[model samples]
Target: MTFEMILVIIVITLMLAGLFFEMARPDLLVFFTLFFFIMTDIVSTDEALVGFSNEGMLTVGLLFIVAGAFERSGLVERLVSSMLAKANTRQGAMFRLLVPISGFSDFLNNTPIVVTLTPIVRKWASENNISPFKFLLPLSYAAILGGTITLMGTSTNLVIHGLLLDFGEKGFNFFELAWVGVPITFIGLVYLIVVGHRFLPDHKSLIEKVREKNTKDYLSEIQPWNRQRFFSERCD
Candidate 1:
């Protein structure tokens, strides 16, 4: 191959190694990789900066901000808690959780939705004597399926839409993906509820272990300043 292509392969290999080994922050590694390409004249500064100016990237950033605000509003927590409260069985709980998660993901960015709901689902599973593993997979699957339903549901859709617009093509309609997404999401949810949950490991999270330990036996000791003081306080 050409010298430039060989150099690119080496640089990318090193970058992947650094990321896999966690030798530096991910953002720093990516930034430095781009900077290296610019310095080597593999890409012009304008070309390198063009991606940052892409509408898709800006939308993803804005979506993260909006998702953060919504998460902070405590609405998600309340909604999840209310849903879990109404379900007494594991299947019922999974049904309740997955349905809303998929619906929420249709309009919002699914990454934040998954991250925000993970701990809540874990806690609920622990309390109800169900494995967090059982609910966590369904949670992720639901979010992914939900994101497919709308153009704004995931970053990938927006990125593709932006690329299309950049190429002077008409971009996707908001619900253009719903035709396939809706059916796939329905089938995926059914699979998770009917069979997938059965195959998940019953792994207990560290938080659950700690909580159980605390509930069973928690010990504390306090020392008195003096025997006389201790006795006096007791007598008093």
Candidate 2:
């Protein structure tokens, strides 16, 4: 195989591995397009750096900061807590939780959202006398599904946009992907509700709680659960 084809294979492997491992440093891969351009001499230095100058990048960053504010301002907590309180069953809570989280994690860091909410969700299940594992996998899966919904929704989406622009082509619109993504999201949610949940763990035990404090006078707590107590300590 040619060197170019080998490099493409390596990149695809790394992307999948990064996502699978939920690696913290995956952000470094965000600049691979720049490296590709430099190696291929696709454009002048100024043209190559234009992605950093685009309003799209700013918009994506602003969305994350806004989401962070939502977390720090008690908004996400209040919203999630409200939903959990009203949910009479674990399944019900999972259905409701999917909406915000799928959208939020698609844009922001999926890892943080997953980690932060896992304990809260476990507490909800504990309060309702249900299994947190029934929905934890679904939660992670839903975020992956929903992240494909918009151009600002995921790193791959942004990378695609930059690469398109680099080729002097039009980039994706905000919600164009959502055209197909929404249907996929709905289908995935249905799967979680129906046959798929049978594979979920039967019992989940609460080990500890997750607590958060921010300089902006924000504090939130999550009740932790352990299935295999050892697995909980990996903290990745």
Candidate 3:
């Protein structure tokens, strides 16, 4: 086994471990994975970098900007205000107004959905003394789940449908994604509601404690090595 291959294996292991442990956000590791492959000469320069030039990435970035524009226009504020005024509790709000809002995002860009609804959710999270993660996941899951219901719900579905046509298979209809996606989404959601979330990483950065530090402290749940708790001390 070559040293380069060994190094490649280590990088892949680290990336996967981070993802499985939720130590770092998935998007952050994507670049590192690419960089590792490039450094290991696993892919040529052009091949390694070509994905950024793809039209899909540009389209998503543009969509995020457009969504942010709509959010900044205060329409989101008005709508969120109305919903909050009517809902009596946080979970009730999620089930009632927020879940539908997330579903609406499936037909649109999730970036805009995230940007528009994040503030509303943060405020609600604060008012109800709930962690942001508790509701944010529900909000994200709803939007993503709704997207699988229709071909136009997400660009990825459109891309897959196009691929099917290129392969001489029938293309999808508006609701075709839900044929399989609905069941998978439902099962995953039930799992989250039942178990996965109970294990969610709690960084302990509550809404009022939020700062630039907290925002970027993605791995805060992992405590640093102190003398008292160190494996080094035990070994000594």
Q: Estimate each model's TM-score.
A: 0.85, 0.59, 0.61
Question: With candidate 3 superimposed using the best TM-score fit, by how many Å does residue 215's alpha carbon deviate from the native?
Answer: 23
- Compared to the true structure, candidate 2 yields what TM-score? 0.59
Question: Largest TM-score belongs to which candidate?
Answer: 1
lDDT of 2 by residue, 1-236 (tens): 98867776777677778767877456666466457657776546887777687655655666667666666777666778897778766567777888778877656745456656776777766766666788788888877778878776666787778778867999998888888888988788788766678887776555322212222546898877766775767754
Candidate 2 Cα errors over 4 Å, as ranges: 1-63, 103-116, 126-129, 206-236
On TM-score, the stronger of 2 and 3 is: 3
Q: Over 4 Å off in model 3, which ranges? A: 1-5, 17-29, 53-55, 89-92, 128-134, 152-174, 180-236
Give the top-scoring candidate (lDDT).
1
The better-scoring model by TM-score among 1 and 3 is 1
| Per-residue lDDT of 113 in model 3 | 78
Worst 10 residues of 3 by lDDT: 203-212
lDDT of each: 0.89, 0.71, 0.69
Q: Give me the runs in candidate 1 sitting further than 4 Å from their true place.
A: 211-236
- Residue 133 lDDT (model 1): 94
| Worst ten in a row by lDDT for model 2 | 207-216
How far residue 122's Cα lies from its native spot in candidate 1, in Å, is 2.2
lDDT of 3 at 160: 65
Residue 147 accuracy (lDDT) in model 1: 95
